[model samples]
Target: MRNKIRIPKRPVDTTMSKTTIPVFIYKPEILRTDRSLVVKNHTVKPVLRTLLFVLTLICITSAAGAQTAEELFNKGLESFKWQKSEEASEYFQQAAQADPNRDIYYLYLGIIYHQSGKLQEAEESYSRGIGLNGGERDRLLLNRGNLRTAVSDYDGASSDYSAVIDAGGPLSSSALLNRANMELNRSSFLLAVGDYTEYLVREPESPQKETIEELLNLLNTRLASDAQAAATAAEQALLEEERRLAEEAARAEEEARRAALMEEALQSLSSSGEDTKSISAGSENIREDFEDSALED
Candidate 1:
C-alpha cells in the first residue's frame, strides 16, 4: 500500500527509435526535492509511535505491598523509559507478583510481555488488568485494540477502539484514527470515513492534518464506491422481486380462468342430464296412449 506518487509523461517522438535514424528521449531526472514529501508521507512516524507508547506507561500506588511493589514498579518504569526491555520485563513481572490486586501492575506487565514477543502472556495480562479496572481505561483499551489487530481479531479490535472513544479521553482522536484504520482494513468504507470525520472535528490543529486530509479524501472516494455498489445491488433486487410477483400473478390468473371454465362445463352437463330424463318420461306417456287406442278400436 505504501507507494510513491509519480506522474509519468510520454515523449513527443518515439525515443527508442534512435537506431532507425529517429530522435531519442532522455530520462528526466526527477529532482530529489520533488520526492521528499512523497517519501515523508509514506515513511512510518517512529517518534509519534514512541510517544503513544510512553503515554501508556502506568504509575500506580501499591498500598499493601508498598515497599516491594513500589520499588519494583519504579524500577520497571525507569528501565522501560530508558528502552531496557529485558530489565523492564523482569521488574514488571516481580512487581505484578508482589501486588496482584493493583490493576496497573498487570497492565504495564502486559505491555512488556508484548514487547518481548510473549503474545499469550500479553493477552492474558491485558484481560486481567481490564477486569480489575486497569491503570487508565482508555490507554488499556487502545493497547488491547492494537494487540487484537495484530492477532487478526478485527471485531475485538473494533470493540476496544469503540470503548476508548466512548470513554472520551484525551486520546479520543487517536482512538478514532485507529478505529478508522481498522474499518478501512475490513472494507467498511463509510464507517471509516465517519471515524476520520470525528477525528478532524476533535483535533483541528493536529500535526498530521495534511496526511489525514489526504486519507479522508481517499476514504470518501471509497465510501462513494461502496454506496454506488450497494445502490446497484438494491436496484437489481427490486427488479428481481417485481419479476417474481408478475410471474406469480400471471399463474394465479391462469388458474382462476381454468376454474371458471370447469364450473361452466359442470353446469352444462347437469342441464343436459335433466333434459334427457324429461324426454324419456314423455315417450313413456305416448306409448301408453297408443296402447289405449288399440283397446278401444
Candidate 2:
C-alpha cells in the first residue's frame, strides 16, 4: 500500500496575476479610546502652546517695564512743560524710583519737587543727583545753593559755591557772585569785598557790575565813617574821664587846705586864753597888797 501511494506524482503550476487595489483614508474618531488619546494629545499641545505664549508675554512685559523709567522721565518733562505740576511730580517720582542711579531722573525729580514747593525734598534730590557724577552737577549744585540762600543758610550756600569753584566749571563766576552776596548778607564785609573784587576782575563785562560797584562803594564809605565815629567817640570819652579826674583832685586839695586852717585857728585861741588868765591873777594880787598897806597906815 505504501508503494502504490508513492506511484502517484504531484503536478506543479506557476501562474502570476497582477491587480490594482484602492487605499481608503478615514478621519480619526474622537470618541474611541485611541482617538480620544490622540485628541488628548492635541489638547495637551494647545495647552503647552498657551503656556509658551503666556511666558513670552511675561518676557515682553518685563522688557517694557525696563523701558518705563526713561519713558516716564520724558512724560514728566512733557507734563512739566504743560504746567501739570502734580502729574509731573508723580511721573518724575516714578521715574526716579524706577532708575535711582540715573542722574537726570534725580535732577528732574528735584526740579519737580522744587516747583511743588517741597524745598527739603528738592534739596535731597539735588544732592542725590549731584552724587551721581553727571554733566549737570554744577548746575544742580548752584540751584541748591540758591535755594539755601533763599532760606538764609549762607554757610551752606557758600559751601556749594566753594564746591563749584573747586570743580572749575562755567558756573564759577555766578557762584562767586552769589557767594559774595551771601557773605554780604552775613556781614562778612571783608570776605565779601574780596570775593566781589575777584568776581569783577574775572567778569569785567558782567551785567551786575554796576550794582556790585555801588555796593562796594557804599560798604567802603560806611566802614570809613564807622571808623571815624569810633575814633571820635573814644577821644571824647578819654577827655571826659580826664576832666572828671582833675576835678576830683582839685576838690581833695581844697579840703586839705581848709583842714589845716581850722587847726591853726584853734591853737591861736588856746594861747590867748592862757595869757588872759595870767593877767587876771596878777591884777588881783596887786589890789590885795594896796589894801593891806592902807590898813597898816
Clashes of each: 0, 0
- Give lDDT tens digits, candidate 1, residues 1-297: 334333233233232122222222322234365446233432335544443344323222222233477777887898899988866877787787887788787788889888888888888888888888755667778888989988889999999989888888786778899998888888877788788888888889988878889988887777678889999999999999999999999999999999999999999999999999999999999999999999999
Clashes of 2: 0
> What is model 1's C-alpha RMSD?
22.1
Candidate 2, position 156, lDDT: 89
lDDT of 2 at 110: 83
Q: How many backbone clashes does candidate 1 have?
A: 0
Candidate 1 positional error at 104, Å: 4.6
- lDDT of each structure? 0.75, 0.78
lDDT of 2 by residue, 185-230 (tens): 8888878989999999999999989999999999888778888999
Which regions of candidate 1 are displaced past 4 Å?
1-70, 74-87, 99-104, 128-137, 152-155, 284-297
In model 2, residue pairs whose N, Cα or C atoms come closer than 3 Å (at least 3 residues apart or on different chains), thus clashing, are none
TM-score (all chains, Cα) for each model: 0.61, 0.57
lDDT of 2: 0.78
